[model samples]
Target: MTLTIWIDDWQIQCCGESFAPGDVVSWKLLEVDPEDYADVVGSERAREIDCREEHHGQGEGQDPTPVEVVSVTEVHCRYGVPPGAADTMNCPVPGTTVLVPVDEADGWAKARPDVRFAGYLVTARQVRGGDSDDVSAAELPRSPS
Candidate 1:
């Protein structure tokens, strides 16, 4: 079963660094089974395995690929101006830039050095051409899984 929970007024801890919150950020939660260490199809482990398989014969010319644990749950992020205290997790005003903290950015970066958490920062903008509000849990479709 999957559930959607709202996170508001939170601080994210990066690699020994912390970011203040001021904007609304969305993230997908990836739940991994601890007992099921076998690689799940189409999962990060499977992708890594595919990568290694593709470069198995590349020899010294190939770039080193690092593999790490595939266990991940929730991922959160934020982004550009200094954070001002906000009482809720609502979206910020349009054109507002703020620095957002990415979940496990430091750890992820260590595994994939080319990745940077700063790239997750985003500027807020108005939602157009869709339902901008009223995304209550009751409105979401539920599954029996």
Candidate 2:
């Protein structure tokens, strides 16, 4: 499943530069690392040392989960677009811009070198799509022949 990543934080920069904050980007789910009990206990001990320490959170304290990113997708934002734009995954407008997979961007960039890339740095406003529609393939599994 793909998750939305806000590029408000600087990560990657093109042309020997990085993107600025308030820029919303997309990052696909890659891998997740579960927090260990030992680490949690250690953190708890450290907190104990500082009596004034305040922990604000829920669900398994002192354990931070790690997630690995597969790829970063820059959003091609359009001007005059409403604050509440269509839901990219399920846009209902006939002329509305839609969402696309990031894997397809590499091919598109290579094919059209002169073409501007996505994001605020580029001029594109709509994300191009990847190959394959919403058709399931798990129906036909391979056999151990």
Best by TM-score: 2
Q: Looking at model 1, how many pairs of residues clash?
A: 9
| Candidate 2 backbone collisions, by pair | 13-17
User: Per-prediction RMSD in angstroms?
Assistant: 19.8, 20.6
lDDT per residue for candidate 2 within 8-100, as digits (tens), equals 112233212232232322222111111111121222322221111011222223332122233434333222423476743422122222223
lDDT of 1 at 60: 30
lDDT of 1 at 71: 23
Per-residue accuracy of model 1 over 8-45 as CA lDDT, tens digit each: 22223321222222323233212223122211121332
Error of 1 at 101 (Å): 3.8
Models 1 onward score TM values of: 0.19, 0.22
